[model samples]
Target chain A: MSESYEATVTDPVSAPMTCDSNPVEEWLRMDRMPHIWCPGCGIGTSVNCFTRAIEESSLDRKNIAIVSGIGCTGRVAGYLLLDSFHTTHGRALPFATGLKLASPKTKVVVYSGDGDLFAIGGNHFIHAARRNLDMTVLCVNNFNYGMTGGQVAPTTPEFAIASTTPYGSVERPFNLPYLAQSCGAVYVARWTVYHVKQLQRSIREALEKPGFTFIEMVAPCPTLFVRRNRLGDGLAALESYEENAVIKNGADTRECDLGMGGPIVCGKFVDIDRPSYLSNQVAHLRKVLGDRYVMPDAWQGVVQ
Target chain B: MVETKKSAAPKAPKGHVVINTERCKGCGFCAQFCPTGVLAMSKGFNLKGYHPPIIADAAKCSGCGLCGMYCPDFAIYGVKNGRKPESGDL
Candidate 1:
């Protein structure tokens, strides 16, 4: 289907002269095309999957709100052309929870790095998942604090070297999918940057599913994490993930922990249905107040 | 475009690649993971001094956006010559 267009397009010669635009161009703020993430960082790849998922869902874009905490991944909110908020460190989940509560119809997404989600906001993460808030939480775990210059983080694998832990971190890292699963997340999945298609598909699935959905994206931190650990460049890091990652959909979350180097189990670990925080509240209020209860306009028919 | 179902040789998937050279940070992700080896890093550097991937063999392209999927910078994307938005039919 070669046409006359130059290097940028492959449109047919007889096809209508539609505007030349990349699929992602429409979703992003063009002015921020060159994001701050260093070359080979996995955050950009995750963003690609995210845009694709949003497009696939066919949801009203205006009704979706994205919130991010302070970190390299937090910059995503500024890049996407949507209602986004770059909240304080570790506060992204709470902000997203409030957003979901205020407007039940709006799709709230909390995207942040491991440091922000697990280190600073660990309590919020556990509480939100326990409450089964209706929101999607994407934790881009680079293993360390990338923005703070390669410091050790809560998700840094045990025995991994970081700036703060030159002799190797002794603390056991949090197994993200396991944590999410135990905390009562409705959906739990983990994927490295190499599993772009799977990550995108899971994000899409999480977006549509009600209640708390948690996705752990193991992206490369080329500038800090990779360089500090002598993990070659970003490409090498991604290649390592490709080589080591084992797809284990429906695997037990207990076995899905990452060591310094070994088989990296990646898949959708848990998917179960239950009453969401909002849905449960609405259901109980209606039963107690009977005819006197006034159901919120958005949740009128969503009692169950 | 002539409809050529001519079944003897399976029609190879066609793809269009749009590269923003200036936006590229010279990451070899697109070239390294192009499944079909349709791209290779160029010898010359962009203004940013990074060697962006150039189309090595355009004909081998299947229009799978894996290159775009792995790309850290929004420097490159592959578009399948589908009728319309069906290419990104994910």
Candidate 2:
């Protein structure tokens, strides 16, 4: 069957007001433009949403800190022109928590891949969520570890084949949204790169939200996931997301199981206001340490 | 209709279009398609030795993605304000 493409030019649903499209050069390191991610990789789209969220948040860039772990998605820290730390694998959350505790006013963000977050860093992920830290954690779930020769990750489907699993994976994948919700993350949402506008909106909301805000982006890893699964190309995987994903209100984890080949649920799964770890830490510190602590006058007394 | 003092000409949106230096070939398509006298050929050359377009009157930009969509090579992209959700503004 031959496929015909149609272009539709619909009238604006609202007024035709002009808005500024200024290049955010300061926020972006132009040298880092044309990123290192493979072509058709959804990490770029997620990165775009992240940068747009930061721009829209109007947060003080000087006061913002980004922490990332090892993986393809972890490289986001290097692209962003902010106070970022490219830390060891699966340790982004701990470093971000430290930064948040040191400077409560600073906005801390953690960017990692499914392998880094759900595999080796699984323990840290749950503990961090349980603590309700005031930070935005973006976990890019591409089903496999694209950076490390496409190994099967904790989020890989039960039967999906990977480099390590030549035949098929027998182990089931972790349900990210449900795990986060159960672990006590205050805000949780999931979106694919196909839903750019909605993903950007969710990122913005997550940035503004207090406590632990976890966003699981079901990104397309064309190089590994697609090639092995015979899913055509990267654009084909993106089209699949556009066709298979559904944006439903109040959608829960039970309805979006990857193992059962269910519809990809994309929306804000949970959002509730709660006191963050920093605030609670400060209160505990004051109560325990009392007023005995005083700022040192000079760096001479500090020991490395 | 009662005539009031002519309102000052509405200023166009600022910094509407952006050119990706890596993909842009300085084909002058953007300048050709620009309805307003905002974009022009830049004196400097890109890494590829192409004279990329530059915004002459940034204030006159209308945030239209015409240049971006028309470029043979998808070298340009636009991000308009207000239409994008602004976080922490609330």
Candidate 3:
């Protein structure tokens, strides 16, 4: 089957250009070329979707601010030539929220890892969703802590073995989409690296959304996770994702249970319009602070 | 002067990166390594607060496979334009 599929996959050289019209390339940080992800890692796939979405949206790089946290995924902010913040672990969202509130015109995005968001930063995640801040939160779930070595993470499945869980992880994993919906995120969706086109479309829509948006991407961890679990190589893991993932309409987080041994659900889980935190804050300030909030006397003043 | 008819150029082969989530831990390793500025972390937590890596650009992959190689979890890989070289033939 692998041989047959390989035979059918298009050759990179002859494949039709799907990304030519994307304008983000003009501002790509080529100096950061040869990024350091391991072979067969899915973060590259996620990156592809992100750039495509930015290109399709035709967003101005000058008006965008990409923020990230600690771990491999957090490096995205540094790689982009646009204004970015390579911040502390599990704090990408908070920083992004501050940026969005300070500059309502700028499009702030927080890119972070599972451990950063779910483990240490779980509280921040829920608040960000509840507040419905005007920002895009893209979470890259790989299953274990890949940077500091593969340890059992909050998303690690029950009975999955990790460095920390030598006998297999007994803890249950969190259902991301359901959590986002319940917390009031305006937009929520899940996509794997395989569905590149759909991923790009969803991202573009999420970015255009007026309120907080969350996209959970299912990527592979062939090195640590696969090696620890003995799940073969990167290609084999991708094949597994292709086999296990089931695309269904109106799928929600409640329906997905990593411990249940069911089909992996993938689709646009939710999209709704709500009052953004930034807009609400501005309104509150206008009502409360009023003229008492004195404007800075000078745009760029030099104190004598 | 003779008018020269301009022809549309052939499109370049577009490459992309893909992730296998079941094998992913949401480690954010790939998000850190993408050179073309395409990947990002998900805001929501997966079954594990591990918000799997997402592809932000399907077209800018350049087929480098750097993320896949650097991924400690090996959750990332490349989908090139052409078929894989036949086994025992490469």
Candidate 4:
């Protein structure tokens, strides 16, 4: 693990060389370093886990495509050095579904925020899970709409204060894991920013799952959510995760609804195998057409 | 005549972290998240007028890399003073 070199006069040869290469740089667009995320924001931490999972899985980097919708978490696709799509608001799941169907060999990942996924795109989320489409969806739940000011969202817990809910929200929030599991997601997991190792491990597992894998990542929105809720700075928010999170791996998703106060349940709740949409379609075509049917190559002509 | 001095491969340095002080945004995440409590915010300010973290105890560093994992900015990372592992080990 060493290279010998003969230094020339123009080499300056003033200082000893060291391995300055950073491990995180290889997976990122280094020129895009110093991302727009607020200081101490947890989205970047999730990005770290993502790159690590990609590396650990030993997948071909070129075949992985990242898709995102409009929001703070959506910026993940732009920062990664992969084939990424930043689609319209609340449309990441559908876009990813199309991409996955087009190129079955390519690994498609949809990463976006709660407001973008659960609020506006909830119908798409449920349908995609119901169809058991092959894709990984990572939702960063900051509990409110971070990009469009501190507005309340479908995932915002009841009684939590948002710019839109100054008097406290009377509406109940959706328990994402429960919703995903009920909608037929094959894999469901949740983790907070403080659980870095667990988050990374869950990403690795979700990447390996075959159909409709979903991970709910809770992060701190220092600028908007934190300020509006009177939650302390980003660091304090992580401290809160440490204090409030409870790991219950096999707990029923029905009882895991998170509230404004009390312990937040986090773990992998559902994992089971069933026929995926494309797989079932292929099976049906083979059974009906017999020798007449020929399987088409991924990314091949579908319109024809 | 040009003279070139050949130095033996540098010895493996001790495990320590180097902070890019200017890049820090005074988030205090490193100080709060360090498992060994080896980091603390310095009283001094960087050019950006933000307090940066400093190594409070060099002896406690095990190079666990939690600081780098939690840091939103790529301002901090772990430095290992050991032989590089074979390729494909990552």
Candidate 5:
């Protein structure tokens, strides 16, 4: 907490309610009201679910750290009243990994857009999940890169009209839950902003989960994605999600492939138990090193 | 997407919604998906020149807080009269 804006990002449960009427208002940086999210953009709604998820998760706010990379959804880190890291483009996972290693007690949540997470940061995403790090990755998939005038992103569905794909996208979009589940993530889920409560609950579940957890939030980008594709405005996109999204909890991730305006099989696709990376490494080291072992304190008593 | 299944509303008013017109972007998600049809788009516009949602039928609200959850601008929220279904969405 610095003198930059006389507000502290700590202990939500104990802090006095500045905006008693709206509970989520406490978690937001009120000074930054009327965020940059477009009029019909679903990012704001996604953020609402996130703040509510954090509250309902009942986790210690002081120990939770939010990390994000460059993009439209990447701006989420700056708006929330928390210890957040706005890292370089496609570097959010790396920063989050380092943060988790340095402060093992901290809950690292990497919240970024599809382009940031699945495009440039794609390698980091798989590797982090492969190691099963104790972290949560919330990827907002709006089908295309909205901020940069609707460029075709890694998650852009086939036959979609993006700026890069003028006629239609010929490339296949990434089935996010399948990627995370195959990479050994302990928990994986997908939900649209239309399913706000479900998305919030899924996020809370991911927060409480031990190993690597991945949740893809399907949000609509009205300014870029929606308008460019002629899918109507933000409300029309939400309506499509309402019409197409099917809730099938415990469904196979393989069947969750999304096409251009097709059935979106959404649910908790994967939930499996496995030893986390750090704890396993620590246990192995302690056994081999015997009495010579000493725990590493990278934060060096400054973070707490 | 889960709010479509409509059961009969309770006899008495369940909740009331508060709207901050200034921040509303007038996406109309709240009014369209309100399960009980509690809200409608206001004829007037905010400072941003976007029409905000107004509570049209106060008695029909079920305190589900779906409007608050669906609201992208954080401009409106429903306050339940008593305990609510699933609670926890302001």
Candidate 6:
């Protein structure tokens, strides 16, 4: 390989031994380890950055909730120690919106894979961004349906090989950032696993921001996506990310579509403040009721 | 946002990583992500028949913990003098 890291080596098999405390254990469900992800899968990298973002954001852990849809990345909600919900496929966004509206104070985070988010749940995604719900959606775009054995997905780069697309995919891929921006998402960013530091920072920013926020994490599915395509192992995918990703903050979202092979643009494409659903509702109520409608908290006290 | 001190030396602290060898799946993430390139897949194999990474040079480690962040299995973490490397204030 042209890279300079020690990624090409394999030792002879040996007997098992005991392991010790994991530093990230506090953020994880210990009984779940070792996780089901392949040795070099980048999902773990996103999880690491997320936990770090939580730690760095200083948000109250009890008030933070994670919602995930069914997929390989959907397993993230089950792995996290926070209050998390493993929702049905393509439903994490709507589920998170319910949670956010119910408790407004809680920081809801939607974590799921591209297949779950873009393929089936895509409708909810656009509407949520259009309404500007107050929540953060983190999508791990592995470019295929990872849990379903590498089927073609909405985010799979055009012409990439998948189980369903044995010869090559003849479909166009979604430019996620452009979709989110056009739908009025307030904060949007994209990062690959190779950009861990920047990814963590962007996640932290997403967590702290208001209104619908979306961050796309480009990770490797070495087991299915990589192997099926003859791409090298997990680390090789990471090396590719390092080599091909170009960081351009504030780049136009329309130009961020990814392809099978080429320079992948990464950046914070959008960040702006706008009235969220809750805030707009509250404002409308205040203006229309003219002091006749009591605030929900006060009304609850009266009912009790 | 709190600003981190820039007065500190740019070099990372001298650190060592603890590889939970048994848990390692021989991904080489630690070796590949370490900024100082302080680790490498060793000739020895773990129980899973995967090659676990080993510290190639203690002096070269910066204790930045990128390996820990990149590690999908959480089988590795960096420690400097028995404590974690300093993190920016929350």
Stretch of 10 with least lDDT, candidate 5 chain B: B81-90
- List iRMS for all predictions: 4.6, 11.9, 13.8, 9.6, 10.5, 8.3
Give the DockQ-based CAPRI class for model 4. Answer: incorrect
lDDT of 6: 0.84
Candidate 4 per-residue C-alpha lDDT over A132-158 given as tens digits, one digit per residue, 9 for 90 to 100: 998899999999888788799998889
> Could you tell me how far off, in angstroms, the CA of residue A298 lies in candidate 1 after the best superposition?
5.4
Residue A296 displacement in candidate 1 (angstroms): 4.1
The alpha-carbon deviation from the true structure for residue B27 of candidate 5, after best TM-score superposition, in angstroms, is 0.3
Q: Clashes in model 2: which pairs? A: none
lDDT per residue (tens digit) for residues B1-90 in model 4 = 879776787533244454666567878887888888767777777787777777776556555667777777756655443533222222
Q: What would the DockQ be for model 5? A: 0.24
| Predicted model with the maximum TM-score | 1
lDDT by residue (A162-252, candidate 3, tens digit) is 9999999989898888888999998999887766667778999998888889999887777898778888766566667777888875775
Candidate 2 wrong stretches, greater than 4 Å: A1-24, A259-261, A284-304, B1-21, B24-75, B79-90
Against the native chain B, what TM-score does each candidate's chain B reach? Answer: 0.77, 0.72, 0.68, 0.72, 0.77, 0.74
Candidate 6 chain B: minimum summed lDDT over ten consecutive residues — where?
Answer: B81-90
Give Cα distance to truth, residue A245, candidate 2, Å. 1.0
| lDDT tens digits, residue span A1-304, model 5 | 1212112111123222322356567788888887988988999899999988888887899989999999999999998999998999999999999999988889999999999999999999999999999999999999888778899998999889999889999998999999999999999999999999899999999999999999999999998888988899999999999999999999989989999788998889888999898888777877999789777876435222
lDDT of 6 by residue, A79-138 (tens): 999999999999999899888777788889999999999889999999999999989999
DockQ of each: 0.38, 0.06, 0.05, 0.19, 0.24, 0.28
Q: Which pairs clash in model 6?
A: none
Error of 5 at A163 (Å): 0.8
| Candidate 2 A-chain TM-score | 0.85
Show model 1 residue runs off by greater than 4 Å: A1-20, A296-304, B1-13, B82-90
What TM-scores do the predictions have?
Answer: 0.91, 0.72, 0.69, 0.88, 0.89, 0.89
Docking level of model 2: incorrect
Poorest lDDT segment (10 consecutive residues) of candidate 4 chain B: B81-90
Chain A alone, TM-score per model: 0.92, 0.85, 0.85, 0.91, 0.91, 0.91
The fnat scores of all predictions, in order, read 0.36, 0.01, 0.05, 0.25, 0.34, 0.39
